[model samples]
Target chain A: MQTLNAMPWATNFWLAIAGLLLVTLVAGLWRIWRGPTATDRMLAAQLFGTTGVGILLALSQAMQQVALIDVALVLALLAVIAMVAFVKRMQGPSS
Target chain B: MNLAFDVLLGIALLLCAAGVFYSRDLFRAVVMFIAFGLLLALVWVRLDAPDLALAEAAIGAGLTGVLMIDAVAHLSAKNAHHQGAQFDQTGARPQLWSRILPVFSAVIIFILLLGAIWWRPDAPVSLPDLVAESLPESGVEHPITAVLLNFRSYDTLLEIAVLLVAVVVAMALKPDTSEPEAGNSKDPILHGLSARLVPPMLVVGVYILWAGSYMPGGAFQGGAILAAALVFLKLAGFGIERLADSLLRIGLALGFIVFLTVATSVMIGGRPFLTYPESVAGELIFFIEAMLTFSIGLILFSLFSQAPPPVAPTSSLQGEQDER
Candidate 1:
């Protein structure tokens, strides 16, 4: 079998996977919208963060656009900043 | 397959936007807004603009999400403290016309954008070609970097000025009275994670900055990543307050100063401002990007620090001892 990178069919195959990832993100958005607490909303957003990275990586591989990988890397690493901000806010003096 | 993916992305974006707008809870709205930004980054990738994707992810989603979440928390705290006074002074529901006006304007802007897209000229002149044709002379292998730092360096100069002004204004705001309490005794998890996380993030941040010349990563993304790491460290009880007075000040201004000097000095050779000599253009742009990275990081740090959030005090050393 031809390596995925060399095959023309890979783009379509990977794009379908990206579509599925998009569906997962939409489900996460539902959780954000229906949140019973701020933590729930934040956790849903965190889920989107990881899923977004996944979508980018899949596309990066399919399109062979290596730059998308850098974007993915940065997203994965910095994604926690918002969560840190949230927890800190919750634990602030007033809270 | 591509068409289906595009359709899904569009629907997801619309749903996220609606979630941000219609959510009654402000905290949920802010979180939805962040999810919206992440979706927009994905859209940028699909649009074949990885540079925009990077900016959207790092600055648009990551930094802005942090800022807005902090704002939400701060506002709630303030409201709790001044509940009666707040209700008496500003509790009136906005006038109908006042609320309607923004939505009206937003609709108008949306129509105008749609019209612009509809009216796009067939076989439109390729700006990409124009940029590509002159990229080698501009001193960078990446078109966006070349345009940003050399070809249209003035735009970048002004952008840096905008960031600088934002930092200045943020500084002028009354400092938060509550210092982020030191020691993470309440949450040892975050304290341990920060130790393992920050050093590698710093390395990745530097790598992104250095890769900008021929890659999608650039000073803006690099600086934002570094800034995020700093925010994480501060949250975990590491004191960065000492650097704020001196080194941070220098880093905040370094990019603008270096770019301004380079732009004007080139004019001494009887050339237009910011026109680099082809032989040294690459080296010069790299230097400028380096300064820009440092400055961008410092400015973002100041943005977060001026309104420093409270840190959870949990000493990892204590945790280790407890385990032993």
Candidate 2:
């Protein structure tokens, strides 16, 4: 494992990007928390899905680990399933 | 910089956890729980446990969120007429005294955990060392895969058995009456999106399954992805209702059946149960993992696909006897 003194900029740069994306994620969480409607909360959760992918991508790059990228891919692709389930639930059985 | 990142991540995790429990609406709480799962995945990454990170992101955040939202929807539908008491029994605010024990217990547990971590010797004997030593013979390059499938195969076998029992329990709970009719949509956009999405999902699931031999990916992650793909197809209005029940039943049991057969058959060599002969270890493990992927996928999909049993269609004794 490389120390903080060596290759400092690369790790810090990627981490900085991750930190900013996390801020966006927290903001999305705020919307989810304060939601007056289930749909609004679901949409904000979707934002969490996308922002999570971004954070994973940055961390993977920073760590120079390709496996981390696979986590991002799984999150990105399967993220839609939750949304689809939400939409179906919203439509109710009559739909 | 690293410390700063850790601090922010810790704060985000705490906030998400709080939001999940404190939110008044069950739906909002479920949504916040998904966010918490995602942030927990990030924490796993920071701690250098990529396997857990992947599992948490896929199963915890993705599929679990789907399941919870589905559950909440069913619940709200049942209680729709009673909406005036929105915070009914399940969501009722706890009494003040009710909160004290839980908080105190949580604090005690947290302190114990911290003490355990801090008390560890500088160079503790590690299980990884044993796993690594035996890994060459385990027919897998990944330590986790080796440990799971070979070194401690019993645990993995029992884990699969637990999944089997869960699916069984779910099946037993299913309503006796015939399933409700499908509500197929005629939306062309949904059709178009489903067509574009499913192929890639299948490919990715298979890739994850195959990569498990040498990497962080494995059957659980792959199976969850495959299950998600099925869920997506169903949600897009695919008429999978016609799929034969026998076929699904076979798929559900295939993993355990195959794994058990292979494990016992290997005992014919008089080595031990689940101990692969060195010559065919890789082939045996790959085949077992492949079967497990499909079975796991089918089980999880069925759990999500079936609705919670509706009030059993009011049936008279005569009608039940006639069906029997």
Candidate 3:
């Protein structure tokens, strides 16, 4: 039962995660803007999904709740299905 | 000391994210995104969520990477005419203020949220206490297991339904393309690497599934890893057609059917739904999880490979003739 005062590492981890996620936000926005095609934007969205998972994991640690990790898992799984669906759509009907 | 490590990880993550966005070639961008995913998994590990890290690596990084690469290939093939360096220099000249606004807003929101969390360091106690107290009687030692199965079993059930719905929707959207057409080239290096990688991956996936009872690994993580292996095999042109058979269909349905049957039986026994009899609870849980792994693996691989609905008998004859 470590008190808040003793857990400086958790604070540090959150700060680190926030900074990284900010960069991901910037990059993802850039892709959304400069994407020449629909597929590029979709790829960018997938990147955001990956970053979101990372942020969720970091939050789980800071909150000390393992349930948040399950949310992250579900998010990851959903992201994969979304990516595959988009890819198949882009491929179109193969003659 | 903690701040320094945090800053370092943040910087590393930022660099990778930038690489994913700024790369000119679509293929390069996809590869960088995969690298970013791996780094994100590391951050999750650092954040004390090993189960999430596993899922992130297998599904987020591995499966998503494969899908992105496939998309890139498909897109590149369709638009082969516009080939000379796709990144345009002039397009990069956006107004500075326009770029700055979004960044500023994001930072402000982040700060406000962080301040709120820090201000209330003690999360009001009831939920945490409830979870802690109920864990022992839940038939599982891991807190996540307790949360997922005992306290929030209804949510878990709905989550499975959502997964199945997504599969159905995806299937409806994509026209059938299940047969292994001789389209993609075989890279010797990739083939060699996959052969080396897949066996160990299978072993690890199973170990994760069984060890999940005591640790931060589970059916989802294991299934995602197994899906990755199957996807790898498909990408390398191994047994793609065989995967479209009835066996895979049975594997894909096992989890949902077993779970539904057990849950319904509990209701018939005059207890709440999904409540297992005390004597066979552990065995029942393991059975559900094992079936879940197989079902999830097959479903994801089918989704990735876009395996068409199982061939009609006449279509099988056509497929064989086409193969010949």
Per-residue CA lDDT of model 2 for B38-113, tens digit only, reads 9999999999888888888878655798888767666655555454434224755788777677778889999999
Q: After superposition, which runs of candidate 1 have C-alpha atoms over 4 Å from their true positions?
A: A1-6, A92-95, B83-108, B123-125, B175-187, B308-324
Predicted structure with the largest DockQ when compared to the true one: 1
- Tell me the TM-score of each prediction against the true structure: 0.88, 0.91, 0.68
Which residue segments of model 3 deviate by more than 4 Å?
Answer: A1-95, B21-24, B81-101, B177-179, B184-195, B241-247, B307-324
TM-score of chain A of each: 0.88, 0.87, 0.77
Give the Cα-based TM-score of candidate 1 against the true structure.
Answer: 0.88
Top lDDT hit: 1
lDDT of 1 by residue, B1-324 (tens): 888999999999999887876655677788999999999999999998898899888886558898887776555555556434331123555577976787899899999999999998877688889999987788788888888888788999999999999988887783646554454444577788888888888898898888889878788988988888887887676777447466767779999999999999999999998888889999999999988988898789788878744333222212222332
Worst 10 residues of 3 chain A by lDDT: A86-95
Candidate closer to the true structure by TM-score (higher is better), 1 or 3: 1
* Rank list by lDDT: 1, 2, 3
- Cα RMSD of all models vs. native, in order, equals 6.1, 6.9, 10.3
Model 3 CAPRI rating:
incorrect
Tens-place lDDT per residue, model 1, A45-89, is 999999998999999877778888888988988898888877776
| Predicted structure 3: clash tally | 0
Candidate 2 backbone overlaps, count: 0
Docking class of 1: acceptable
